[model samples]
Target: MNGVQLLLVIVGAIAVSGLAQRRGLQPALVITLVGFAVSFIPGLTRIELDTEIVLGIVLPPLLYSAALNFSFVSFARNFRPIVGLGVGLVVATALLVGVFAAWVVPALTLGTAFILGAIVAPPDAVTAVAIGRKLGLPKRVMSILTGESLVNDAAALTLFSITLAGVVGTHTLFANPVLLFLYSAIVGVAVGLLLAVVATVIRRLLKDSGLETVLGLVVPFAAYLLAEQIEASGVLAVVAAGFAIGSSSSRAGYQTRLQERQVWSSLDVLLEAFVFAYMGLQLRFVMEDLTAAGDSVWEIFGVGLLVLLVVLLIRPVWVFVSFGRHFLLDRVMRRRIASDTRVQERIRVENEQRIARGRRPRQFPVFLNWRESLVVSWTGMRGVVTLAAAAGIPLALADGTPFPGRAEIQAIAFIVAVGTLLVQGLTLPALIRSLHLSDPRQEEFDREQAEHALEVAQAASAGVYQRFLASPPEGVPPELLERMTQMVKRQSADAARDPDPDATSAYGEAFGTLYREVLQAQRNAVVDERDANRLDDDAAREFLEQLDYQEAAIVSRLGYRL
Candidate 1:
């Protein structure tokens, strides 16, 4: 296919995926399956495109957009677990699969097998977050999965690079892989931080919402390109920059929040659909490879199953063994020493309350819950990086003959990707239900927190009103305080209500009536000022813009139509 055909396919896939998402199916899965089916048509097999276009052009923006929306606070708080799953897990999976693939796949070299293992090691953030949101998992579980997916891509890419070098005999293990890994990681982080700081400073100076929003779009590309020029992982750079910006966003301004929400949400939807569609479109190449090696298909299938089993089983076993030692047995031993002390009694009561509330006791150093373990296991779906790495494999071997195991490797990678993404993702919700995992208490906690946050906002508004009453700002209207008072009271009431259908609907209707009146009054004031020439063209435009923002906020609060 030419450029135009590829573009059409992408756009069509996105449109279909959007409809599927609304109907409660995973857009990624739908798009991939459709793309795979389309590629089977006889004429469609000749489609050829630049692999770099997919990897370099498409990946950076998607990764950056995902990173920008990630929660830095939660990521930092859960750093240990995130690192364990992201960096450590990738390394472990690669080593295990590498050894097994070399032993099981008859003519494949250890280096080539290692490359295959590295290719499928990282999970896809787009698939993980999309499925997580659809399944309505708790914030903590989503946070863990999202964080792991973001960082693990870097780990997988780095491993792939090293293994690829080894495959061509350009590098050796004695060349110090550890040092190269550390160097790449450090450079990626430094580049990202430097670019993020520069972007922040520039945004502050301009302070124009449109300009700031455009700058946010460009920052990710800058991070990715600069890191790549320095021979570091662009994926790592984008993830680091995303964390930096998310952490700093609150101090930036309200406009930053509005702009980020608009920019990332649009980008997120488009990229999520496109990446999976690309994966599906490549299925024809994989299938062709399988058809030529029909007899070796069973060998490929066995290796794929072995890798999948290893990936799935290792996680739970590791968690159980680690948690048993650090949490359960250790806690019991500690409590035994404190048995005769008053502190022990206090601890016992605290543990009882924690148990009643479905919390792990404070004495445990590690999380021992089955729910957390299941989330970790279910989040192991690999996507774009795996496909890209597999596709990048050299087409020829040392004697210039075709690569011996190219088809087998591609087929195996495809199996793992589909198996994990479709089977595990689909079963995750049922697994959570069967495990009796409910996050109602977390929902209640969030509601209370929102109430407290709204109270603080109301108190600030009240304080502002009092100041305005004592000495209003010049040109401030007499009705400003009354309008502000009503707004504050409405917000407080909305916040206090349980986020349920009945309470939200009741408050929403009342707020809608008040909001329309307030909006109409503002519009009239703008018209009156313009007619009287009390406001210039520029001033009227600014006023309208501010009013538009306020109206959108009101609608969002009421959960009404935009």
Candidate 2:
């Protein structure tokens, strides 16, 4: 498709996806299936798009925005499992798949198979988080999935590079793979840290929300570009920079928090929509190769099955073995009994007298739950990175002939991606329900903590009001404090309300109507301003943009059509 046509397609896709999501369906799934259907049309079949443009240009922003919005405290607390799944699991899965592919596919070399393996290792953060959030999985589960998706790309890319080097005979696979890994990792980490530190310093000095937010955008690209220039994993650098910014900026203050949240939140939605839509657009290019031969199709299907089985089976086994070895069978049984015991009084007594006094209760991170494990397993749905890596594969062999299985590999990779995203993504909710896995009370506790925070904010505002009563600012109006006090109180009360109200019932309908009216009024005002010429071209555009954003936020939060 040409530029204009692509833009139109994207706009249309976003509109449809938004509508579908508003109707309580998965937006990614809708967009992908729609894109798949659209691509099948005769006129649209010949569209040529750049995969690098999608991955390099489009992906960095989405990844960075996701990392920025992720809860730093939750990520930190669950760092072990996140890292174990993110970095360690990517490496392990790649190695296992590489060995399998090499052994099974006769014409493919070990390096070539490793390249294929690495391509499919990292899952799409957008898809994983969207489904997880919709399924009402615990925040900890989302955290691990998000964290893993954020960083696994780096590991996959690193492995891809090493495999690439081997493919070109630039380096032997056995020759200093460790040094290559170390070099890329150290440089990426250093670049990310330097960029983050500089960005933090600038934020503190400027203290302007717009400027700080704008600077925050540059940090990710800066890290990515600098790391790439120095022959390192750009993805790793961006992820590290994101973690640094998120952790550091939280310590800055309320203004930083508010501004950063707004910036990332807005960026997140646009980038997410664009990335998934782009992933869907790839169907136009790969569909022909996918449908070529029945045998070829079976090979693709078999590879996808192997990948799905490996991803699902390996992680749980790894978790059980890892956790099991650390704790004895007797200890495991006792802990399980304690956790599952229906008699709260007896459990509490045992805990106080025997378990609490002398024996320390075994502690596991919140992300270690079976619910999280299932989500993590299902989340291994690959996207742009896999396609990009496969496309980047060199076309020629050592003897200057064309590479063997190039078309087959691309087709297989596409199948694996689509299968995981479409089937596994859709089925995950049912699987979670079937297992009777639910988030622990900790998530409810988090809501309460947020409520307390809002209360503190309201109390602080009231204290400011009292201080202003004692002595007001030189030019400030006295009525300002009263108005601010009322606003703060309303906000606090809203925050204190229960967040888990049944959405399909009367409670949801009540709040839904209230929010829908508020959004509609805001939208009408924007149109009125535009028509009345009160807001000029630029001003009206800005107002409309803000209005659209608020509308979407209200819809997402309330699950009500506007």
Candidate 3:
């Protein structure tokens, strides 16, 4: 498409996305349907890009942006489940779908079918994650879903590479399939870490917030390109870089943090909207390609639907069967513990000791209840990556022969991507609602966190005040100093308690300085809590934002730049 068409698509996407958000609907689902509808309008140009550009340029920043915001602590805590879904489930789905596709499509070889499998294997869970966040899914469930979406692309793409090489009759470096995957993953991670360190150091040395954020934009692309250049998984490289950079975000200037957050958020919306709309717009062209290739339209469409069904069915089946074993095993262990008094006493004593040391009592890892399992099982919505990978299929192999069933594969992939979005994306919110799922434990944990936050802030404020009393600023009259000190105490104590934005501050030059100091202390305390893992990353961020606002307000009133 030309520049004018691209501009129109973006404008239309944003407008529709705004409407969807206002109506409390999933913007992605709305955007896809609208794009599909718009595609039928006369004289509309079909938008297309080279598959490599789509994956290389578009995929990295989105994944990197997500990784930057994701909590490393949370990611590590839920590593097992994330790997299970991201890697294990993706491989299973690819193999299963590949076998099914080859069985049904007689013209396609096993290698090409596997390529199709890899294309559709990873579900873009952006929509699911967004809906879950809005509807208040538990933290762990959100983490698993988010982490799965982050990691699965690497797995699928790696498998795609291996299969693609096989189809093209090219020899890869690693003779062993397992060794190839391991090399891709390990090298990808190493590349990401090395780049993250370099980016962080450069940003720190730059010491300019705007420059830092601008550099932040380049980091993802650089990481992706660098990893791919070395035959590593660029997806993992981007993710690793994001995680590393995000964890060090606290060290950057607050202005940098604030600016980077808004930049990435806006980028995410733009890219996501355009991608879904692009998916919708291409349906007509995908069909045309298949028809032009002399394939039976109805037969391809039927295969698409069956493949979609397989994609949908395999997730819940895998989730339940894989996770259910652990659930059942835990039940047996719990029953055994109940029957043995000695074992029960030992566990109780250990937990009590842990609690006594100001730590949470030891508990088993998160085992999803039936409701959670159901919600997870149904969240498979294939999206941008699938379409990109499918369209990326080479037209000719190394020997200059037409790639087998390329058009058919793209058609089926488009079908599955659109089909899952319609099928699962539309229904997931309703399923979550119908189940009446609530994480009371998460709610209580948040509540306790809020209380702890207040306590920490209060302590920090008290310490600041004590320090001010101990050493008065030079050259202030005793009477004025006394008055300023009283004002500082009142404001510090009431700062967080007052939620009224309109409340006028009594802070002048002297009081403002003291209040800013108090805010800084409180921020430090919260950061410490976060570093120690005593606070949830989300909660820590929220508290830190409040402090930032307060500091900004004081600085603004003082006619100073933050």
Candidate 4:
């Protein structure tokens, strides 16, 4: 697509997202539906989905954003289930779907069917997590969803690479697929951690929030593409970098963290909008090709239905066999993990422990209920990543006879993605409601979180007070300093009461109202300096930017999450 068409797509998607926002629906669903409707408009430009754009450019930031916001502690604690679902379940789904497709379709080769299975295997838990956030799903369940989304890409891509190697003529990776998997996982993680350290150093040296944030925006894409160039898992690379950065992000300047969060949120919305919109637009394309295969409409529906059922069913079954059965057996065996040192570390959350000044005795329950398993199963909606992987399949093999059943595979993939999204995504909220999960001890949980934030904020500001006492700024009175410190303490107390506050969610409206006059004064002064020629144009703009940033900061409660 040309620049005009691309701009139109983005602008149109955003507009539809706005509608979705107003209607309390997922923006992705709305964007896709809008794109499907717009496809029939007279003289509209057709935009093809590019695997490179989706995988290399788009997937990284989405994964990074999800990774950054997820609780690394929670993820680590739940790594067993996360891995079981993200990696093991993905493989199982592919194998089952491949077998089912080859049996039912009759035309698709086993290799092509496996490729299709791989394409649709990664459950786009982005929608699930987003919905869970709104619905107040249990923290443990939310962690599993978020964690699965973060790491599943690597598994699906690994499988895709191996299967694609079979389709084409690359036997090197196939000779010892386990070694290829190890190489990809190990090298991808190493590359991600290395890049994260480099990014952190650059961020510190730059010391400019805007510059640092711009670099932060690029970190995930860089991690993915660079890792891929070195024959590693690009998906794992992004996840690793995201986890590294997220773990240490507490050390970053508040301004940089705030700016980065806002930037990523906006970027994520835009990317999802474009992805689903383009996905819907391609429905016509995939279906047109499928028509030439001369399969009856019922036959087509039967094949699509089988793939969808397998994708959806394999998850709940896997969750039970992999996790639920283990839960039951653990009671009989009374087992404990071998890593006692690591188990000691997981006692209390690392963050809460830091506030407590050391590790504290704490008990955490890891349990899986049938309700949660059902929720997880119903949330297996294939997304743009699935579409991209399928689209990425090469058109021709080494001998170049139009990779067997390419059209059929693409058709199946597109159908499965749209089908799951519509059938499962739309129905998931209702399923959650039907499950009737109890309202947990919300008040107690909220109290603990409030106490944690209060302690952390006090610890942080105490160091600043100590620095000020060491060397008081010239012209600043001790009385004024004391008053400012007291005011900050009061605000921190107020903020401790906030449950979750992002840039968009204003937890400090009272503070914003109090500071409005001062912000206006700063804006006026900056404009006056520019008008009087006391400040150059660039200097005036820079001053205005800082003023705007501070003004925006008024609404946010930094370092507040529960």
Q: What is the lDDT of residue 53 in candidate 4?
A: 73
Residue-level lDDT of model 1, residues 1-562, one tens digit each, is: 5778778777977797878878988776778788888888776654544545655666677777767766565567568778887898889888888888888876568887888789888888666666556666666667777788888887887788777665665434347778777877888888998889989899889877788888988888888889877777676888788878765664454456677777788876776676667667777777677777663566677778887777667666655565555566666767775676777788889989977875546654445366667666666777777876776666664457777677777777877877777777778667766765557686676555444433433444454445445764344356654554466455434423332223254344543444444444544555344434333323443444454565455655554522
Ranking by lDDT: 3, 4, 1, 2
lDDT of 4 by residue, 1-562 (tens): 7888889888998899999889988777677777878887877656765556767887788888877766566677788889888988888888889989988887788887888888888999888887877787776787788788877877897788777877787544326767877888888899999999999889889988899898898999999999888777788888889988876664566577667778888998888888877777766655666676665546776788778877877877887776567777666443453446565456446647654754333444556777887788788988868876776767678787767777677777877887888889999888988887545785576555444433443454565555545665555456555654455445444423332224343323323333333444444544443444333333444444444555445545442311
Q: Give residue 117's lDDT in candidate 3 (0 to 100).
A: 95
Taken over the whole model, the C-alpha lDDT of each candidate is 0.68, 0.63, 0.83, 0.72
**RMSD versus native structure for model 4:** 10.5
User: Hey, what RMSD does candidate 2 come out at?
Assistant: 12.2
Regions of candidate 2 where Cα sits further than 4 Å from its true position: 43-45, 49-51, 125-128, 168-175, 206-208, 250-298, 326-375, 384-404, 439-447, 454-562
Best candidate according to TM-score: 3
> What is the lDDT for 496 in model 2?
32
Can you give the TM-score per candidate against the true fold?
Answer: 0.77, 0.70, 0.90, 0.80
Candidate topping lDDT: 3
lDDT (tens digit, per residue) of candidate 3 on 1-562: 7888889889999999999999978787788788888888898767877666778888888889989887888878788889999999999999999999999987688989999999999998888988898888888899899889888977898788778877977666687778878998899999999999999999899998899999999999999999988878788899999999988887776678878889999998898888878877877776787778888899998999999999999999989997789898898988998899999899899989988876677776668888999999999998777866776677788799989888788888888988898899889999999988867687889978877886877787777777776786665456666666566555554535432222343324556667778777888888787776677877887877777666655655563422
Clashing pairs in 2: 1-47
Candidate 4 lDDT for residue 298:
60
Q: Give all candidate RMSDs, comma-separated.
A: 10.4, 12.2, 3.4, 10.5
Clashes of each: 1, 1, 0, 0
